[model samples]
Target: MSILPQLAFVLILGAAGLILRKRILFLKRNILLGKDETRNDQPNERWKTMFLVAFGQQKMFKRIIPAFLHFLIYVGFLVINLEVLEFVLDGILGTHRLFAPLLGGAYTVAINIFEFLAVAVLVSCVAFLIRRNVMQVERFTKPEMKGWPAMDANLILVIEIILMFAILTMNATDQILASRGDEHYLALGPLFFSRILQPIFMGLSDGALVFIERFAWWFHIIGILAFAVYVTYSKHLHIFLAFPNTWYSNLKAKGEIQNMPEVTQEVNMMLGIPVENPSAPPAEIGRFGAKDVNDLSWINILNAYSCTECGRCTSECPANLTGKKLSPRKIMMDVRDRAEEVGKSIDAGGPGLEDGKSLLGDYISKEEINACTTCNACVEACPVNIDPLSIILQLRRYVAMEESGTPAQWNAMFQNMETSFSPWKFSPSDRFNWSEKVKEEEMK
Candidate 1:
């Protein structure tokens, strides 16, 4: 323990903190770029949702095998990180096993528990890698996952394995050093998993063993800090965003679609209902629906950011099963990519970048939007409660209302709805005629 290591630790920790802060601020700004809507109702329900979905991971259990494996990694991540508090204090205060003397026997138990979790995490990561690469799970190899998405997934799994190994290695070497009465080495009973590694290092000289132990110690802590910052830039961001995203999730009935106030007012006027008269000049007209990220509600953007890209949504989507261009998972990924692009553009220039492209044409396409049956399957399948349907509806609204780009069949259906109050060509007065004909045929 020296001032130099403490100072280096402080600087590394500070740099990671600063980078993470900047990324978080950028993400906040990007998410806030969307239109504002109030979702602050039912604080009690919101908290319950966050606890059940994010913390409890209730939705993940739909598929028992994968769910159990995922739970191992999730629990491992949380439990193993408990040791990080000790790591921080040790690094800053130049102490070793700072909590060992205080906790007494409890320290050994905690270390053993951490070691067990570390092994579980390592095994889980390897299993995940095999699933993604060797087994080539269909959902994981979708077109959207061809490049960086695929790499990002593998990179995270590998990083977790490495970090876990670092922890076990550090513990094993520390145990060996303690046997030799090395300074600052606590003689806690050997951690089960780490104890197995001790035989491999027994032949090394005292100085080499010390170097290996210190290197592993520094690598584990530094790797964890680096990972904290890397998560903001990776799909792994859901690790943190899932909590708030679930907390602010849409709590309305699944089948309910929020109405456009302006459209509702116009419909009211057409139906001869009394409407409020404007007392002053009207506000400037806005686009009918979302042509870009800015026209979508903030929650929709947040959904994009919080997406895990697990493909459950896409796997469940009927349109995708039928070989349509649409994949709800891809839609969310596109939205996130477009939002990131816009955020970077604004960072480089100013608001002037708004004119160049949009989420509609640049990232998502009309065919994909049209393919949606609005079955809500994607919404139902999302473990994180993301509503890909909401984004689809907004983009569809922009196409139909602003661009008037619906196909001829859809246009005919729209015309029928406007005049006949149904999606058929017949008048509303004759809407029941088909039922009457069916009754007559049955009677005959």
Candidate 2:
């Protein structure tokens, strides 16, 4: 009969595991729907990038207040999860304070630290809630963040705050029960932060205190499990994806645009540039660039799914600053939305990418892509190292290569660059005249 609670716990955990596995598969399948591209060149560099950017929260320091607050929550939440480990073991073994007797003094110290961190996490979350909602931060209030995105951000914060409260509540009630000489509740020294709440619960009966403690324990664990599953669908999916996203981030110089191998090879053949390997296979070329989620690389789609939709990229974009339609943030969101739409359709026996809808025109507009200055501001601004410009370039490639011709001004620049080796109308011979004219003006 005592094992019944343990059995129920096992069942609940197993269900959560199954649901989490389903979400993982759904995310993976949608991401893999994209074309393959090589992003696995440097293991050491990738690890460093992940460590510095994701684990270390290095880039987030650009805005110190939010970064510090976020770091407190990030670090505190992680540290406090150690206590959660004890909670899980207690649940499974059907024991109260399972680690307390084993670790003794160390367990008390550990939980005290966890309690302190829990308080820190609680405070940090409240600060973030105010910054995001009450303060109405500009980056957070963008058009893409209007509905679900905004609510998801707030909801995650609220969940964390509530979970922190559950921890404090459990500890306070456990302390009270311990004082009352409850056999099951071992007195784990003073959890200083939670002790402040002792007076409030002191008036409660021992039975009531035990019930509250048990309820809070269950609540904390259940909330964590549910939060894990909810994150896959939330912008907080970055919680899992940031590591991989930063690792696979573009390693080359930011402004150095990637050229099509097919186009490069063709140009090389025309220039009589010797082929490095004569026996090598010819470059593969099909649809010029991304028309839909199907047209982008797996990493690109991964980038879409990994997107936090924080609007940092859009907020930093020069075009967006100039009141252009281009929100680099929106481009990523559109790709993710299109991928989900297509993935669901294919799963439902619908037309998939061929359903007369595409990522190019139907989801992301031509004006949005065209408005990009390609200044790489969005790329630089992304905290998790998400490359929105890479996605933008691919969409632009479809317009130029497949759909034929970019904006008229871009066409003129392309023509000039090909003929005169410049983006101006001047002939190659007269290109030096500008330098001479500069010299003449200096003399005058």
Candidate 3:
């Protein structure tokens, strides 16, 4: 068989994968509605976040075992390409170790290291499955206990298992081939599988060994391609999206919201509010933040594309876990559904209008935004580094600043911020009260 067939196959598959990845990323890039200036506005902070979050995977490691396991998975998946390079050549060109001792033996060492991590990845994946299915970890369940689409959860599990099995199968096949005494053999005894497979392969005929090797090579190659295509359609899409998403994650403080574009006084502000008989329109107003699906910031749409739906954000969210009616997964999913709907309108050249018939009318209720604690746990737990809290803050800014419809409890707080330069509703005159009391009491 010509090596060209397999080479062409891999090249074709790789190009298809790259093209799909680019198209989706481009679609996401153009659909974002909100402020993206924060991502590049501060180069130093963006660099720091990139290094700390993307390179270090800092937040992921908060739960030590899982973090460590993911590290192995991430590093192993990256370097496992060396083995793929070998497999493609051996399978196609009929020569093993085509790049013998390539990268100054770095490739060889990577093979062993990745194999070790492969074992760890399998074990961790199994543990996670059991934790989610059997133990019913709170972090894995839906907020209302209504249960998620089991298909989505199970799809992720199956992908990880297939990935691990493919690694093990490839390593086992390589070891078996090595034991047959082929001159092309590189040392394999050091591999954990070699010791176990040595006695068995030693007894097999050359013809039998060759057939098994061919089968293994085919299985490994086909399995990996299937896995790649499957990932694009699954929640595991974040396996690729998360790193770049986190690198571009919003870094502003919770309350420091983005400003809407300004308008001239003659423009008739006409701030939107569904509430009946609300106050008069302002002197000028831009579109209220997220009044409708179309009004959402472009970054909000990006949040949808980037969402892993791992339920990590929902799990860590105090509001959702406590049953106060908030789920980050649902929020992202809603935004996604709406973005797709609005995107169709935008594509059709229709004006993206927001009246009372808007996304904000019911699903994303007024109560829901105010319910958020702004605790930042959801932001912290998000593997992709999505900041739903930022969206909520921006929504609040619109409600408070434009509509002047601040929630009652927050009304006093906003007033304090304006009058006293703080959210705490206390007189500035009383600021020295604590100092005076402390000094006098201590002296006495």
Instruction: Output the number of the lDDT-best candidate.
Output: 1
Error of 3 at 295 (Å): 2.4
1-444: candidate 1 lDDT, tens digit per residue:
359999999999899899989999999998998888899999999999999999999998987777888899999989888899999999999899899999999999999999998888888888889989999988898889999999999999999999999999999999899999986798997588999999999999989999999999999999999899889899999999999999989999988888988886777778998767745344455888889898899899899999978899998999999899999999999888888888988888866236688899988999999999999999988889999999999998899899999889999999989888888887778767779888999999
Q: Write the per-residue lDDT of candidate 2 for residues 208-299, one digit (tens) a residue.
A: 88789989988999999999999988778887798899999999999898877777777787899986675788866778888888888899
From the highest lDDT down, the ranking of the candidates is 1, 2, 3
List the candidates' TM-scores in order.
Answer: 0.96, 0.94, 0.73
* Candidate 1 worst ten-residue window by lDDT: 276-285
TM-score for candidate 2, please give it: 0.94
Candidates in order have lDDT scores of: 0.90, 0.88, 0.65
- In candidate 3, position 120 carries an lDDT of 68
Clashing residue pairs for model 3: 32-298, 33-297, 33-298, 34-297, 34-298
By TM-score rank, best first, the candidates go 1, 2, 3
Off by over 4 Å in 1: 350-355, 432-444
After superposition, which runs of candidate 3 have C-alpha atoms over 4 Å from their true positions? 1-4, 7-15, 18-38, 87-95, 101-108, 143-150, 182-189, 194-208, 261-286, 340-363, 396-444
* Lowest lDDT block of 10, candidate 2: 275-284
